[model samples]
Target chain A: MSIEIQNLSYTYDPKAKFKKIALKDVSLSVEDGDFLAIVGHTGSGKSTLVTHLNGLTKVQSGKIIVDGIDLTGKFDAKKLRSKVGMVFQYPEYQLFAETVQLDVAFGPKNLGLDEEEINVRVKDAIEAVGLDFEQIKDKSPFELSGGQMRRVAIAGVIAMRPEILVLDEPTAGLDPKGKRDIMELVLSLKNTLKTVKTVIMISHNMDEVARYCNKVALLKDGELVGVYTPAQLFEDDTVEKCGLKLPTTVRLARVLKARGLIENDCLLTEEEIVAEIAKGGRHA
Target chain B: MREISLGQYYPTGSLIHKLDPRTKLLITIAYIVMIFFIDTFVGFGLVFIGLMATVLISKIPVTKILKSLKAIIFLLVFTVLMTLLFYGGDKSEVVLSWWIFTFYKQQLIDCGLIACRLFFMVLGPTMLTFTTTPVQLTDGMQSLLKPLALIKVPVHLLAIIMSITLRFIPSLSEETDKIINAQKSRCADFESGNIFKRAKAMIPILIPLLTSSIRRAEELACAMDSRCFKDAKNRTRMNKLKFGWFDPVCLILFCALFFVVLWLKFNFLPFVDLTSLGWIV
Candidate 1:
């Protein structure tokens, strides 16, 4: 397993008047190179679990073995962080330096990389995020638009060269075009960056996640409700029960099936639905 | 990181919330001055009684008021300790004794008076903050400081900064928590380290948090610009401060309390005369 969580649990303000159990014995595993999409309602602890992978939240009563390193109050958290770089929801918030190049190079510098090596990593990371290395390198990140700032932030994490790239709602507050571009960029990075073996992301946009992620983990009230292939997981009714919506394609397929227009349950894509409709026409 | 409670205003139609924030602010300042001026138990009793009456009329939970005291517990204890160690009675004979320490009758009285002064200083203003929102506080400050603007004090700019700081505090705290957790998932332990190690570990969090804050500031600037928010431009307020019947009544009550405090401090109440008591020795 690229990442393994066993009976993990976490609570916040455990002794306060408003104590909360943010995670409740959630256990799951993701294989190397798995594009796992985590979905949940607000305050459902999806963010809590993914954060544990990098040691943001300590696992109170569980075992989180990520790439064979036990992250249970014993390991070097900073080294672990370098290994699994996280891109926050509003990635632009991570842009601290004046210039784009310096901002992108922050992670590499934190990793204690040499100046020459850090320069290469910054250039490669900028390129990996499909940002022009020369055109905007010297410009202040503050002067860039929202999309460019986000790219710079992502490149900052990419410069760390983590084995796993975890993102939390990376497309939040972005326009549709911006969202589409970010999703495509992540997919392209996965295709090109062989060392980036695992991509764990939390998103509420069910349709985009369904199209992009190979695996899906559903969380409800701090519990891992289910983990399955997107097709299988989306087919189940529990997703709706957990206050989450299914992908639009899955919803459309269900509607079509309910109308007696389709026979097969495996249709999840637009082209697949078209083929199924054509088959229905031929049979009729 | 929970949002700071300084801007936590429990909205109610009670007398305290209805009072003009400017009136409350002035009254708080005057009450604090009176607290320091009168140095006797009888004066403190009067202030305490007045504060209790205000609390009852405001209808705010006593628990919340007491909880606000939690933040200043250390200061309170330190003040008590200092009073015990430093003060001594001049006319009265010493009572209790320890190694190089003497407790006298007048020293105890002096300590009690100081404690009361500190208590009123903290409690009087806390009631104001808890009852009034940051927006109202800024508006009240702006109105009160209007004279300063003639001297190019930039009262409007100061108010804008205050409001923005109040507005972004919660947002930034939420972001900090998220970034901390994101770093934690990578196994970043903020707890269970020596001071140096802990400080070193915070670099990852601090770097990401600072970066994000700068970015947010830029985004906020853009958003403001797109909405045509220009510096030094007169803008209409969605909620304007106007003196209604409730405000006038509360203002009169506050004025009455201030005058009563002023009278009690200056005439009828005798100050403890601590300076002549040789308490400093």
Candidate 2:
């Protein structure tokens, strides 16, 4: 399913003396099977924009069409939420059931699925996130390690079988290894869960975005600066102008290009840069 | 959903804001006492004027002070309706009759007076909280309750608990918001479920909130232990609470106003009995 946002604006505490404009006339589109990474400084509407996709936030003055459902109209918000599964920052904190199976079954149960179907979905989701269903199914989610608990939480959302998955800072506050594990789990979701057609993630770690995401949307001061593919976004100076840093590999590629070593400016991964450097040596 | 402003401290450079919080606490208590002692309109009028003057002197916006009343509006209206409906005296006369209920003249007057009393009753403490920060209020509370140490009250511990409670309100609220958003994303229906289902649905939110709160408490205890915050007896404050010249003047002014209202309630004003109004006799 594709997602389209148009002319959206949001203000928190609109009547208060310290009203904050969290979003402004922002417009963007996500095509099917696109892994879009939204990057910006804090307080730049990245979270607010993602919330609008699933109807968690009421669209006061804008239009959002998710898989042809106009979100602003009197449509079924809960149904929209099921279609656009959202995994928030520290999602593990939201787990409350007695066992991993129960927690993972929470969403499908809410959907009023039959007992056999819920069990099937729960087992599939837990295994899809790379967890052993038989071992972890009966254990309390709280008993798991931080990374395991996070995977259980993601499995809970995965059980709902959403077409579009929106995650807000999924890897925040995790150790480096834990971050990589979570990112890998998310990257595998598109292939493992066939229903997941579009993935939109809000992330601060530029390296993760550069390494994984195909498309990147840049936002600043509640407005969309521009949307470009990862290579194009890293090459543009707008990333720096918006107080964002390029990924390490992209920055190294830039240095190599400036030194007349590499001809390409779009290298996004360490392996890609290394291969490019090896190619340059053979030509020289 | 951001309208929860009870116990909020408004920062304005006014005399009330600068006065010692202990003095403000005492004044607020004294003013509430005066509100109850007031029986006549003249006495209530005096207290009302005093309250308006204090609100003005505090320099906080009148609208903000009024906004605090929003929380108690239902109670205010209920009090007025109950007092009007149930209050009775042998000398009271019926002013209006509807169905099986009768409205009495004296009851109506008493209801109006009670409503005014309730309004000023809420306004007084709200003014104190508006002008004084929670830290200063708790400090002042600890100092004033120091006298209770002779009676083995654990004054310092009470103060610590109060401060911690105040500090956690905002954090807990922010955590609740985060949890709600997370659950909402998972298609957790909080709004449309039946009453039983809705209550059951709260499990997702309440469990997380309780666990996180416990985790925060544990961390706080550890941090306090690491910092050697063993007992409050040897603790020294960076900013000690002391009464300035303005504090005494403000206290005395409020005290004098209280006495004058008491005196008027007792001696001078001719009590115009509502039964004598002839609408009902």
Candidate 3:
């Protein structure tokens, strides 16, 4: 299954004096099992683009085809939403049920699944997000810690058993440890959950994008500059034109390469750069 | 969706905007009373001229003042229709006669007068809201109600609640918008449903909005406590409200207009009979 977007554009308050162009002529294809990271500066249409993936915002002008289902024409948006689960920024704010289990069961229940099936999905989804289902099931979601509440919120989306999981700044407002935990949970889902094949995440953290994402799409001023693999995106100069900083390890690798201390120009992680440094020393 | 401009203060350095909010409040009350006191067409004409002159002097756009009328347009029409249908007098002449529905010239005139009165009634307070900021209005309310504290009323708390409610309206609307979008992504269908189902669909959005609002209120309370925001009597304002020359001048002008309309209604227009003008039967 793949998501194909063609010439998607959106504008807020289109008829007002303070009209703003949020997205313009953006097109990209996300393949199955691809951990795609969308990186852009603030107001670069990253949030606007992610909202269109699951039919949250209507397509002003363009087309989106998800798994052979065309979203441009009259189609079941509710059915499309079931297939594409979206976790919004601060998803914890959307949790409303009296207990964590009930909150997590919301999506599955909305899908009209049987009660037994919803229960199974809710438990599994909570476990997938690394939350103990039995321990936190009866507790009010509002009483949980910020990190735990965010995990429960993500579990609520995961309970839908969607094929494409889209996250918009899932780790925003979290502590450093919380960020790492959330990212690892997402990474583990890709490896573990057969239902979630494609993961589309909008992130501002270049290091997280470099480490977890296989492909990166750079956007600037509502336009898609290019889509590249993590290594290629860091190695290319187009990333600079997009007004984005290179991941720390990639910048260090470029510096090492400039000093003639490293051979390869593309290095995404610190471990890779350290191995390259050791290899260069052995060669010397 | 940001075109909601009702009851929002227009910031401009004009005679009306510069008037002390206490004086503005009093003038608004006086204008409303005068609108009701007006009975003759000449009196209503004077009140209309006074309203137009205030609008001109306020330097606020005429369209904005007209926009405030849009909110009460339905009320105006309803009152006019009610008066037109139910007003009974010596029905010497009938304008239109139908089965159980009769229109008289006097009833039509009464409807027109009531419409004008209701129109001015809405416009008076709308002008007050347009010219004075919510903060100023609440401050004026607190100051005016300070005497009630002697009778054991919690004036300070009441003012704080009013200000807080006004302050959070826009923020709550923004939060509601966010929650709706978030829930919609979860396949929460809010549009297509029967009335009860549609209301049930709002549970997801409403619950989140409530939780967030409670969270915000708690945070604000904590922030206030940390900043030592208790004891409203000792709290000094950053922008103190002080009555200046403009306030008394505007107050006197409005009082004069009130008396002039009263005089016109009572004594000035005796020669012209309104029923003779084909407006009344």
Against the true structure, whose lDDT is highest?
2
Q: Tell me how far the alpha carbon of residue A190 in candidate 1 is from the true structure, in angstroms, after superposition.
A: 2.5
C-alpha lDDT (0 to 100) for residue A213 of candidate 3: 96
User: What TM-score would every model get versus the actual structure?
Assistant: 0.70, 0.85, 0.84
Local accuracy of candidate 1 as per-residue lDDT tens digits, B150-245: 888987778888888878888878877766654554344568679998997787678767776776789999998998888743756777777767
B281 Cα displacement, candidate 2 (Å): 19
Clashing pairs in 3: none
What TM-score would you report for chain A in candidate 2? 0.96
By TM-score: ranked, best first: 2, 3, 1
lDDT tens readout by residue for model 2, A1-284: 78888999999888888888999999898999899999999889898899888887889888999988999988887688889999988898899999999999999988889999999999999999999999999999999998899899999999999999989899999999989988888999986778898889999999999988999999999999989989888877878889889898888888888898888868888889999999877876
> lDDT tens digits, residues B1-281, model 2?
34455468888889989999999989888887888888777777787888889888888898988888998899989998877667766435879999988888778778888888888888889888889887888898899899999999988888888878888888899899989988877778888758998899899999999999999999999999999888777668889888899998998888899878766555444675443444322
Sorted by DockQ, highest first, which candidate order results?
Answer: 2, 3, 1
Q: What lDDT does model 2 reach?
A: 0.87
Q: Model-by-model lDDT, in order?
A: 0.80, 0.87, 0.86
* Cα TM-score of candidate 2: 0.85
Computed on C-alphas against the true complex, the DockQ of each candidate is 0.29, 0.71, 0.64
Which residue runs of candidate 3 sit more than 4 Å off their true CA positions? Answer: A236-244, A251-266, A277-284, B1-23, B55-73, B80-109, B130-167, B227-250, B264-281
lDDT of 3 by residue, B1-281 (tens): 34445366886778888888899888887787788778777777777888888888888898977876888888888887777767777577789998999888777777878888888788888888888887788888888889999999988788888878878888889888788887877777788879999999889888888888898999999999999887576667788889998887887888888877766555456775544555312
